[model samples]
Target: MASPWRPIRVWSPLLGLGFVVALIAFALQLSSRRHLAQRLWTFEELALYNGTDERLPILLGILGSVFDVTKGKTHYGPGGGYHHFAGRDASRAFVSGNFTGDGLTDSLNGLSTMEVKSVVDWRKFYMERYIFTGHLVGRYYDSQGKPTKYLKGVESKAKRGAQLLEKQKIEEDKIPSCNSKWSQQEGGKVWCDSGYPRLVKRPGDIALTGKISQRCACFKEEELGRPGLEVYKNCDYLSQSCSV
Candidate 1:
């Protein structure tokens, strides 16, 4: 005869485990909502947490996102090396390396697409290293904590920068860069071990930056005369090497 205890033994563990998982998931969701609720901080409020007062936690802002960097007190405190970056959104300075006076501003104006992407990358670095606290209500975000048009534009440029970088990597794999060297006695020389050296438009340079950029690359004989490829000046069309 089948015993009732057998059914309890089979189902009890599964039911208990399911209940525990549901409880943990609910707790995580609630915690996330609480954190997100802390969004929308004014610049003045952010400035108060610059690690001057022991009572307040050290905070830093980047790309509108604020993070609790209290654990890095040695690096962000009043006398720390990165103190200028604390309690302010100096997004541009991440790449500009100008951390004083006007350079500490959050303006991304006139920055190149790749520079803007570098600023975004710095934000990602902080996000992974510190606890996210809130959003700063200025240039990058509105008082209601929504992204501003300027912020959206920066993100779009950054995305384009990433695409450009990927395209460049693909192009490099297809046409590897040529080996090069320079000397006062020998001038400059570029060559390939197995293919001819040619100059080609840098991937995405003109479209993204409106500047025509080119680089020397090695290409197989059959790959010559591609749309962007041009023979080096003073070098034979099929020569594997060139001097500059």
Candidate 2:
């Protein structure tokens, strides 16, 4: 019979290596679970994780939602290009491109419907790319971490913008777009292959923003008198093409 001690010595190195590997895996799992837990953080607590301290993870907030952006240290670190966004909820700054103290605010006041929707989309961006770690207990969230009236209003405005965008797309499919050309010799012209060209306030734009921007759209002969559409300045009522 062989000595039992020989087998133990032969397998000890492999057993130790396996143990170490399992230990590392366990640690990683614990870290991932910690990051996934939803913790309500005050503004001051959030500021501490802004990449200024190596011991803490880099975090950012948008619309009260906080994310672990430590993986993007190249961009969110103290001297990084996007460092200004690492500490607070600066939803407005994403759209305004103002990284200053005043511009880095969460206020959606006076933002157009579409602009609000764009800001909401940025939140979606962070949600997908980074780990969602918590919520900020301020403007958007109350002491209990639930959304406040102000946040609800902003969400409602963004939802309206989404609905309008869908409606505009459907209308475009129905009306299509006019083909056009312009030059020094002919000034400008618009026409359609199977319909008439008319200028109209872009659907959902003026209605929501009080803006007067217009676009050339093609419509059937019977639909020519649809509200908000007008013939080109010098074009005849039934002309297939018109000089602009």
Candidate 3:
């Protein structure tokens, strides 16, 4: 009873509507994929989940993994671990250097030049976070800048750091008592005393997720008649690290 054209018109509109729905769904999927690719934790799919679970190590490890592939090497060198921690605007306290923007370069004091008030055990939580969050180091070039491959984890870097620690121990053996004077250039030949600032925890500084805090509050005081600490009270988290 229907005309041939009626069948064509009905089916064509239905088909067109179906195609439009399908197209919209496809576009949504593509958008989702793009967002997921940009994310640090691909396996966790944070898009549909709570985003707070993500932190520095999660992001840094993702970056390191991709960088390892791009450069074809582990950045931490053989038996070295690469780590990154998020400091909340630490540069405001001590930097007055020549640089621009939000980066480590913004910190005025060179890594080497500060005084050590005490040992806050930065190495302790440092290793612990690296252990919990995990790591991937890429050191593609040797001293001569030649190509290499593969990567290592915290255990490896700690072993290498241990060698450096040992060298420090040997040097310490040569200098007896706290009265002895010593200095080292940490970055850019910036010289300073290298001990002091024991980390102590303050109350109400705890987080259920991610790292707590640790601080090296001051450099050794006796050096140059002024004490120095490897790290000082730079953040609330650092205060929390000592709370225990």
Candidate 4:
């Protein structure tokens, strides 16, 4: 009769403590799930976040590398020009300029020089513009998701090609101008001695001097206006006889 509710009141502290512990446990579980989501995602899981649901982010893959393109949803989302590339590697497609499913692969075999260069350019573009997530485990990667030999080869080729391109540019800048000159009477013209080497014989090869096969005509100014155009405009220098 002192107080009918006294017993329940005395146990209130314990019940409150239990509730606090349960809440903390639930919070920890939620945090762990969030962390897992931010970690590496498999290709199948990536496809689930293709911006189609409006709840997940938009993502894309290139050469086995994944990127978060959510920031570019306007261009990568549904009905966007690049929507087809989302949630897939599609490295070959980028290089071959093929937007079909058949091009959605990482295989670099049989790609021409320009195509390979295109793939390299696309890789640089993604790296500079998007957030890198992880790699895909198909075509460009092995079962365990490690980079495959083919991928490595393609990368090596890209690097080598870039280096070669840079070198070629430098060499081109150093080429001695065929000392081209302009004359009103003859129009623009360039005269090469009996022995003069070509500026470029093959791709990336430095120009080497060669003996003249025959006395050639002076090149017209208009013909020499473009690089390597003079070679096709050879004529008898004495008479300046050649098709302009």
lDDT of each: 0.85, 0.86, 0.30, 0.64
- Give each prediction's root-mean-square deviation over alpha carbons: 10.8, 5.7, 18.5, 12.2
Clashing residue pairs, backbone N/CA/C < 3 A, model 1: none
In terms of lDDT, the poorest run of 10 residues in model 3 is 111-120
- Per-residue alpha-carbon lDDT of candidate 3 for residues 49-132, written as tens digits (9 for 90 to 100): 221222111222221221111121143322223212121111222223322354422122222211110011232433344432
Residue 63 of model 4: what lDDT? 78
Better of 3 and 4 by TM-score: 4
Which candidate ranks first by lDDT, i.e. highest? 2
Judging by TM-score, tell me the better candidate of 1 and 3: 1
Report the Cα lDDT for residue 43, model 2: 89
Cα lDDT tens digits, model 1, 1-244, are: 8766643345588899999999987887566346434677888978888888765677889999999888899999989999998888888899899999999988989888888888999989988988888899988889788999999999999999999988878967876899999999999999999999999887577655667888988888888968878888889988889998
In order of lDDT, best first, we have: 2, 1, 4, 3
Candidate 4, superposed: residue stretches over 4 Å from native: 1-40, 143-145, 176-202, 205-244
lDDT of 4 at 117: 66
Backbone atom clashes (below 3 Å) for every candidate:
0, 0, 44, 6
Q: How well does candidate 2 score on lDDT at residue 173? A: 75
Query: Please, what is the TM-score per model?
Result: 0.70, 0.72, 0.22, 0.59
